[model samples]
Target: MDSVPLFALNDCDVMTTNGSKLGTLENITLNPNTGELKFLCVNPSSEESTEFPQMENGQVVVPVDSVETTREYLIVTAP
Candidate 1:
C-alpha cells in the first residue's frame, strides 16, 4: 500500500472506493483481528474501525487490496 498523508484524508472522495458520496463515512465497519474491511449499515462505536469502507444506498464491500490508488481520496476497482 502507498503511504497516504494524513492531510489527504480530509478531502477524500469515498464514492470512488466505497461506492458512496464523499461525505457519507458514517456507515462502515472494520475487523480488528484480521484487519479485513467490509460494509456495515452503521457505526457501532469505537470498536477499532481500521479498515472500514464508506457505505451508500446499497452495501458494498471494498477490500483493502482493491484500492488501486489513494491520495486525496481512495480509488478502488468497481465490482
Candidate 2:
C-alpha cells in the first residue's frame, strides 16, 4: 500500500481523482488496535451526489487507500 499523508480532516474537501465532488470531510474510521486510519466518512453534497458512491446511513465510507491528500482537497480513487 502507498503511504497516504496525514491530513487535517476538517480542512479538506473530498473529491474523486476523476474530479467529481463527493462532499466534505465529516468523520474518519480507524483501526482500534493499530490506530491506523481505515476509512473516510464523507457527507455528500446536495447536488450531483448520486455520482458519488452510494451512501450508507447518510454517509459514505471511502477506503483510506483510495484517498490522496493535496494541499486543498482529498482526492478519492474508485474502489
Candidate 3:
C-alpha cells in the first residue's frame, strides 16, 4: 500500500462504500518506531456518531486497513 502524509488527509470527509457519509478525518494514530499509520480518528456525523462502538476521546479510531482513499473522501469499510 502506498503511504500518504497524514496532513494531506486531515479534514477530509469519510464515507462508506455504500456512499453513506460517516464523518471527517480529525487525527491519526501512528507507531512511534515504525511511523506506520495505526488508526484514523474521525469526528462522526451527528446522525451516525452514536452508532459506532469503539469511539474514544471524542473521535472514532478506525483501522487503517479499512480505509480507501479518493480525491474527495476516505471510504471506509465496516468491520
Winning candidate number (lDDT)? 3
- Inter-residue clash pairs, candidate 1: none
Regions of model 2 farther than 4 Å from truth: 1-7, 47-56
In candidate 1, which residue ranges exceed 4 Å CA deviation? Answer: 5-11, 15-28, 36-59
Per-residue lDDT of model 2, residues 1-79, tens digit only: 2454455557468988778788888888899999988888888865444433555577777888888877678888876
Assess the local accuracy of residue 22 in candidate 1 as a C-alpha lDDT between 0 and 100: 27
**TM-score, one value per model:** 0.39, 0.77, 0.82
Report the number of clashing residue pairs per model. 0, 0, 0
Question: Cα lDDT of all candidates, in order?
Answer: 0.44, 0.74, 0.78
Best by TM-score: 3
TM-score of 2: 0.77
Q: Residue by residue across 53-77, what tens digits does model 3's lDDT show? A: 5464677778888888887789888
TM-score of 1: 0.39
- Model 3: pairs clashing at backbone N, Cα or C within 3 Å: none
Give the alpha carbon lDDT tens digit for every residue of 21-62 in model 1. Answer: 423233334587875554323322233332445344433445
